[model samples]
Target: MSEEKYTLETVLSVKRWAANLFSFTMTRPSAFRFTAGQFARIGIQVEGELIVRAYSIVSSPFDETLEFFSIVVPEGAFTSQLQYLKPGDQIYLEKIPYGFLTLARYQEPAPHDLWLLATGTGLAPFISMLQDFETWQKYRHIVLAYSVRTQQELAYVDRINEIQNIFGENGAEFCFLPIITRDPFAKLNHRLPKLIESGDLEQEADLKFNVESSHVMLCGNPQMVEDTKEALKCRGLIMNRRGVGNIAVENYW
Candidate 1:
């Protein structure tokens, strides 16, 4: 790897949400630029080798520092070291950002409602998108459905609530649905694809999904993305291609 392609950044802080889930903020290089829904290639040194991985940006594009949400996979090469990150620790960031999941990509048939479906750390990009002022101004209604294995894995609840409050006060219709699949006592206890298949998701949000007005963005586990895509397709929605269609997706892992 060329040194010119990446820059060294300092970790500003790290917050652990659970035994395996955490979020960290790092100093953003002065010239680093990225869209609201993009991922960054971050690296950490382990045993004299640089281990790198792609993590979706969790901070707003306008924010001075960059943030990311991560899950510590047991004995995983990159995350094992990443989970131990501390304030002032040095990490590596690629100079350029990459991703095609931004809302600006939806152009041909303009959408009126925006649906953000995510599971686990897949919620990272959507969080960044919601932080941007343009997201609230562009869509009349927005629904964010986040699913996790357990309640403990549902990260960023307070931050999501804060964003909802800030945008809702301005008349932007935003609904946040949290799904806990492992907890029987949770309000929404089914998987995302199943919820969509059963109409429970729409009923809970009080919003209908249609090809004409709904633009859906899916992220998180590959199975959830794939299954949800199939479920949405059954409802007449198509993947966004060449600036057209109703769905956009990214696989978190």
Candidate 2:
């Protein structure tokens, strides 16, 4: 792999999501630019060694600062160091942005219900998409199907209302369906595949799961993406070849 060109950025804030999860905002260089769904390699220098990992941008490009959600693996190579950062601290941020999960990859001539399925920290890009104007203009009905192992791990809880308001008149078409697997008291307590296969996802979104009428985006866990892809494929959905169908995936794990 090519070495990433790194730059210094000051941490603006850091907040915990759960015991093992946290989010931090950092100063964005005026020259740094990216699509809503792109990612950047960020790390810190210790004893002259530059350690970093790629993370999806959670903040909207329109925002003044950049944000990221991360899970702290106590013994992880990069994350173990990442968890030590605090406000006013500086970290290495790669100058260039990269990823293929942006809305521009959708190859259809007409619009369809944009389905954003995420688990754990995979909800980053979809949150960025909701903040951008292009996603609102492209799909009339936007369903965010977020599944987390626990309810507390669900980041950006307050943003759901703001996202709907961003849709303006079509705000009614925007839906946020949060699924928690271990929470029995929660309304939905199944994984994405079980939910999609059993038709529960469609029932909650109040929309049909048709290949022609919907485009799906998957992110976060690799196994979840794989299982969900099989479920979607059984429903006639396939990965868009040269921008043909509507399924796109990004495996963060």
Worst 10 residues of 2 by lDDT: 163-172
Q: Candidate 2: deviation at residue 113, Å?
A: 0.5
- Candidate 2 Cα outliers beyond 4 Å, as residue runs: 1-4, 170-172
Pairs with steric clashes in candidate 2? none
Pairs clashing within candidate 1: none
lDDT of each: 0.93, 0.87
Q: Per-residue lDDT for 91-158 in model 2, tens only?
A: 88889999989888877734678899999999998888888877887787889989998888887888
Q: lDDT tens digits, residues 6-47, model 1? A: 999999999999999999999999899999999999998899
Question: Residue 215 of candidate 2: its Cα lDDT?
Answer: 84
Task: Kindly report which residue stretches of model 1 are placed more than 4 angstroms away from their true locations once superposed.
Answer: none
Report residue 225 deviation for candidate 2 (angstroms): 0.4
Clashes found in each candidate (C-alpha, N, C closer than 3 A): 0, 0
